[model samples]
Target: MPTSICKACARLMKEKEDFPRGNFDSDYCASCVDHKGNLKPRDIIRVNMIRYRVNNTGVSEEEAAEIVDNLMRSLPAWNKPKTPTT
Candidate 1:
């Protein structure tokens, strides 16, 4: 199996379940997209990451937020400027 990193969350995608709607072409991951396969808002992604870190790793909320913020800033999706919708 091939592996790819999610542009939004930096999660390793190794199987169909890792990609949004099992889309191997998707740059993001299932956790980074909605059920309709649209990329979620940055704030929502940030919150989800922070929450996951805090709950799963027993990290402080502030620390998790800091880590998640830095991580998100480094990701391709979050680093790029958003274009206005027509």
Candidate 2:
């Protein structure tokens, strides 16, 4: 039998998994499915920073502090990648 490979993670699947009302088809494995399910921390940070900046425009200090705290709790999932030398 021919197998379908995921374009994102390149995992093979035998058939499409079906939902109750519709079909949610994918060639990726379960791990890849779970991995892509949520936002990366950096991405969350980037969005929250924008939101905080907008919400803090001449706002109350307490509100601004709250926004900053909410943004800070979303950090620490990423680190700079190290380059390999020949």
TM-scores for all candidates: the values are: 0.87, 0.25
What root-mean-square deviation over C-alphas does model 2 reach?
Answer: 13.7
Tell me the tens digit of each residue's lDDT in model 2 across 1-86: 33554332223445444211122444333333344443334444445444545675866656655765564443222222432312
lDDT of 1: 0.88
Largest TM-score belongs to which candidate?
1
When superposed on Cα atoms, how far off is each prediction in RMSD?
5.0, 13.7
Top lDDT: which candidate number?
1
Error at 44, model 2, angstroms? 22
Number of clashing pairs per prediction, in order = 0, 0
TM-score for model 2? 0.25
lDDT of 1 by residue, 1-86 (tens): 66798888888999889988788999899999999999999999889999999999999999999999999877888777753322
- lDDT, candidate 1, at 58: 96
Clashing pairs in 2: none
